[model samples]
Target: MKAFVLDRYGKGRSLRSADVPTPELRDDEVLVQVHAAGVNLLDSKIRDGEFKLILPHRLPIVLGHDVAGEVVKVGSRVRQFKLGDQVYARPDDLRIGTFAEFVSVKEASLAHKPKALTMEEAASIPLVALTAWQALVEKANLKKGQKVFIQAGSGGVGTFAIQLAKHLGATVATTTSTANVSLVKSLGADVVIDYKTQDFEDVLRDYDVVLNSQDTKTLEKSLRVLKRGGKLISISGPPDPEFGKEIGAPGFVKLVLRLLSSGIRRKAKSRGVTFSFLFMKANGRQLREITPLFDAGVIRPVVDRVFPFESTNDALAYVEKGRAKGKVVIKVR
Candidate 1:
């Protein structure tokens, strides 16, 4: 099996391609022949050791999260799928390796690909779409006629969130460059702020929810955009105590996390709002629900580019540039 291996963690290291032994399937897992894989900032951050404390991985691992492939083998307990079933998934934390010819995925984390999409399009949906679902549908409970602000509307998570928020009937506001103003609007954003010229804090006000995916400066500034009792959910984060407890970190790590978010928490409280960090997990059931929306023409993929399998490094670099209007994928088959 040909795969890209991350032998060590560094800021600018490229993964080395190798012919490793094929992975053995577990009782609740399935072996998938890779067709296409989505690239994310999460992969680049993991390679640079940005998540070492929260998500520690052993040296010499395969790195990827989003996958759309076909099942060639199934484990004993995996009754939901069999040979020749098409599936897509954001595999579990320690088990991700879609930047390869073949990868093993837990059955619970995999979903049937939408019949309306191609393999590359299906690969682009899982991670970013699931993040939006968990944030808007599960956590915020956003309703129609309410207002929500999603930062970086042209990015991976941003593009999907704007669509999902609108589908839920919320009036959506988002920030993107002047060039992308029309792009976000086409995705159902009611208000589009050109971040290069106008400040979002000045323009957006009294919103029900704010989805934060920027740095600390942007996170703090978002407070003014929301009304009292508004919810601020940050995906790019200084992890809060709640997230620390969710992951069951050590006491010292928990204390450090509390201190890291103390300033933002206090500011949010002073403004009569609530703040929490969101680290989305993989869920097959949520993906199942999302698939129908695509079939109904309520949502569509906004893919920016598709790189060849061998140019996986180039794809990562392109995403790191922060210029893509939507998701980037690698054609692995």
Candidate 2:
């Protein structure tokens, strides 16, 4: 099967096209014949060796997180799905390799694709949507009539978080540039700040939760907007000690993470708020719940671009530019 392979970790290095053996299926896994794959900043960060500590991969690997395709084969232990099932997933961190003709995904991490969506659209949903669900619903336990500020409201996670927050009955405030103000508002953002002109800290205050997906500087600024006991979840991090424990980091890596996040953790403590990092994982059950919302028209997929499989590198490059209004996808079939 043809797939893009990363030979070494480096910034600005393009994936090399090659014919590699199809992923070996496990008893609890399904082999998906990839029709489409999603491009994420996570892909780029892994390529640049940014996540070496927490998500170390074997050398000469395939890198992709989001996948939508048909199940060509399923393992004996797979009960809910079979051959010819249309499915989508953000495969487990160690199992990801959807930028290929075929990638094997664990049955627990896979869910049926929404019938209303195209493969490209389905491909765009898993990683970013899961991030939003995990951060707001699972971590923050956001409630109705509460206020939440979601930074970078037009980016991959932002577009989805805004809608999900609104669905959960929270007042949603988001930050984006002038070109994307209307887009975020249309996604049900109650307040939209033009980051190019207005500072979000000045305009947002006393929020119940904040979904931070920006740099260290922006992450720090988000603290002031939250009310006492508010939840501050950073997807882009200075990762905290809790996250290190979750991923079960090495002793040295744990120490490094503790030191790196000490300043922000102390700041959050002083402000009477809690800080945590979110690195979303795959969950078939969560995707099953989310599919109904899309089917019911409560949440919609926001796809900004679709590139051919041959242009997978271009797709990754496009996402790295930080200009996409939503998700970027690579059509593999």
Candidate 3:
């Protein structure tokens, strides 16, 4: 099997392509012939060792989080899918390797691909879409007629979130450059702030929820815009103690998370608002639930580019630029 292998962790290091042995399937997993894969900032973060303390991935690993492909074989306990099933997933953190020709995924993390989408488009959905679904629908329980501000509306998570929030009937506000104002609006954002010119804090106010995917300064400003009892969910995080506990991090790591988030948590408490960091987990059931929304045309993928499998490095670099209007994909098959 031809795969891109990360030999070491460092900033700006490119993955080396090599022939590796096919992965052996587990009792609860599926071997998928990769058709396409999604490139995310999380991929780059892991490569740069930014997540070493939390994730601690071994050296010489294959990297990719989201995958869309056909199931070549299923594990003994996998009854939901079989050979030839078209599926997509954000594989479990420890098992991710979708940047290869074929990757094995846990059955519990796999979902049937939405019938309306192409393989590339399906690949783009799992990681970012699941992040949005977990943030808005699961955590926030956002309802119709409420107000929510989703930062970076033109980015991967933002594009999906804006549409999902609107589908949930919330009035959505987002931040993007002037060039992307119409893009976010077309995605159903009711309010679009030009981050290059206007400050989002000045324009958005008293919102029910604020999805913060930006810097500490931006996160601080986001807190001020939320009304009392509003929810502030930071995906680009200062991981809170709750999140550390959820991941069952070591005591020292949990203490680090507590220290890192204490100031923000205090500020949120002073304002009577709730704050938590969200590190989205892979869930097949949630993806299954949202499949209908994609099929029903309530949410659509916004793919900026599809790089050939040979250009996987280029695809990662493109995503690292942080200017893609939506997701970047690698056509692996």
Candidate 4:
């Protein structure tokens, strides 16, 4: 199997092409022959060792999570899929190696790819789509007629969040550069603010929820845009502890998150709003629900670019540019 291996975390230079053995299938796993992979900002953060405290990986790791591929073999205990099934997942960690020709993933994480999309399009959905789904529907419990603002609306998570919010009958507002205002609007955002020229906080008010994917300052301001008793869900760092516990973070990490968000939580409480941090978990169940939306044309992927399998590193670099209109994908077949 061919893979891009990273022995040590540092700059993008660590990514290198090499031949590696195909991963052995676990009794509860499936061996997927990679067809396409999605490159995400989380991949960049992992490569730079930003997540070392929470997710420590073994050395000489393969760094990709969002994958779309055909199942060549299934584990003895796996029942959901079989050989030749087309599946997709954002494997829980970097070691699964979606960058390779083949990778093994737990059955709980793999979902049947939506029939309406190609492998490249299917690959782009798992991580970002799941993040949006969990934050809006699961955590925020968004309901019809509620108003929600999704920051960075043209980015991967934001694009999906806007679409899903609209599908749930929420009035969605989003922030993006002037260039992406039309794109976000097309994705069902009722209001699109040119982030470069206008401050979202100044123009919007009384939201049911705010999906924060930007820096600490932006996350702080998001609270002001929500109504009393409204929720602010942040996917970016400065994590919240109770939220960490909800996602099953372990002892030490849970304590660290509490300390990280103590001040922010207090501030939010003073304003009569709630704050939660989201780190999306891999779930085949949620993916199953999302597939019908894709199949029905209610939600569609927005692909910014595609790179050949051998150029996987280039795809990662492209995503790092912070200007992609949507997700970047690696065509691994």
Candidate 5:
């Protein structure tokens, strides 16, 4: 199998192409022939050693996360899917390797691809869509008629989140550059602020939820836009103690998280708002639930570009630019 292997973690380092043996499938896993893979900022962050404490991935690892492919073989305990089944998934953290020609994915974290989408489109959904699902649906429990502000509305997660929030009947507001206002509005954002021209904190207020995916300054401003008792969920984060406990970090790591998030927690408490960090996990069940929306055209993927498999590093570079309108994909077949 051909793979782009990361030999070491560092800033601005590229993955090396290499021939590696196919992953051995487990009792609850399936071997997928990768057709397309989604590139995410998380991949870059991991490659740069930013998530060492929380994730602790082994060295010389394969880094792709979201995959859309066909099942070539299924493990003994994998009853939900069979040979040739079209699937998409954000594979479990320890098992991710979709940058390769074939990768093994746990059955519990794999979902059938929506028939309405192509492999590249399907590949783009799992990571960003699941992030939106986990943040808005699972954590916030966002309901109809409420107002929510989602930051970086033109980015991968933001584009998906705007559509999901609208589907849930929430009044969605988002911040993006002036050029992307119409794009976010097309995705059902009711209030699209041009961040380059205006401050979101000054314009948006009394929101039920805020999805923060920016720097500490942006996160702080997002907190002010939420009404009392509202939820402020950050994906780009200073991981909080609750998240530290969720990941079951060592005592030292927990203390680090506590110190990193202490100021925001205190400020949120004083304002009667709740603050927490969200790191999305792979969930086939949630992906299955989201499939119907895609099939029905209620939610659609926004793919900015599809790079050839050989240009996987270029795709990562494009996403790292922080200007992609939506998800970037690598056609890996």
Candidate 6:
């Protein structure tokens, strides 16, 4: 099997294409012949060792998270799929490479690809879409008619967050550069603000939820815009211990999380709003639940660019620019 292997973490490191042994399937796993993989900032972070403390990985790791592929083999306990079944998954951790010709994924983390989408488009949906679904629907329990603000409406998670928030019937407001205002609006954002020219804190008030995917300063400002007792769900993160516990963070990770979130939690409490950091978990069940919306045409993928598999490095660089309007994809098959 050919894979994009990372020799070490650094600047301007390109994936070295090489022959690697196929991953042995676990009892609850599936071996997938990857058709396409989605590139995200997390891919970049993993490559650069940005998450070393929280999610450690060994060297020469194959790096990719989101995958859309076909099942080539199924593990003994994997009854939901068989050979030739089309599936997509956000790999449990950075260790299982989706940037390869084939990868092994836990059956519980894989979902049937939406029938309406192509392999490339399906690959783009898993991580970002699941992030939005978990943050808005599962964590916040956002209700229709509630005002919700999503920052960076044009980026990977923002694109999905805006659509999912609207699908849940929330009045969605979001911020992007002027160029992407129309893009976010088309995705069902009721109000789109140009972050460069306008301050969202000044223009919007009393939101039920704020999906924060921006920087520290922007995240702090998001708290002020929410109504009292409102929630701010940050995916970019200052990982809170409570949030870590909710997601089953390890003991050492929880200690680190408590220290990291202590300051932010105090500040949020002073503002009379609640703060929770969101780390999206891979769950086939949740993906199955949301696949109906995509198939029904209520949700659509917004792809900004598709890079050839050979240009996986370039794809990461593009996402690192922080200017992508939606998802960035790599055609792997």
Off by over 4 Å in 2: none
What C-alpha lDDT do the candidate models reach, one value each? 0.94, 0.94, 0.95, 0.90, 0.95, 0.90
Per-prediction TM-score:
0.99, 0.99, 0.99, 0.97, 0.99, 0.97
Clashes of each: 0, 0, 0, 0, 0, 0
Mark the regions of model 5 whose C-alpha exceeds 4 Å error after superposition.
Answer: none
Candidate 2 per-residue lDDT over residues 32-143, each given as its tens digit: 9999999999999999999888988998999999999999998989999988999999999988899999999999899999998999999999999999999999999999
Colliding residue pairs in candidate 4: none
C-alpha RMSD of each candidate structure in angstroms: 0.8, 0.7, 0.7, 1.4, 0.6, 1.4
Residue by residue across 1-333, what tens digits does model 1's lDDT show? 988899989997999999997888999999999999999999999999998888878879889999999999999999999999999999998888999999999999999999899999999999999999998998889999999999999999999999999999999999999999999999999999999999998898899999999999999999988999999999999899999998889999899999999999999999999998989898888989999998888998989999999999999999999999899999999
- Model 6 worst lDDT window (10 residues): 241-250
> Mind sharing the TM-score for model 4?
0.97
What candidate 3 gets wrong by more than 4 Å, as runs, is: none
Candidate 1, run of 10 with poorest lDDT: 52-61
Give the Å shift of residue 218 in candidate 6: 0.5
Q: How far out, in Å, is residue 302 in model 3? A: 0.4
Better candidate by lDDT, 1 or 5: 5
lDDT of 6 by residue, 1-333 (tens): 988899898866888989999988899999999999999898887788777777768888999999999999999999999999999999897446998999999999999999999999999999998999999998899998999999899998998888898888999999999898889989999988998899999999999999998888998889889899999999998988876677577898899899988887898999899999988888899999888888999989989899999988889899999989899999988
lDDT of 5: 0.95
- lDDT (10s digit) by residue, model 5, range 85-179: 99999999878899999999999999999999999999999999999999999999999999999999999999999999999999999999989
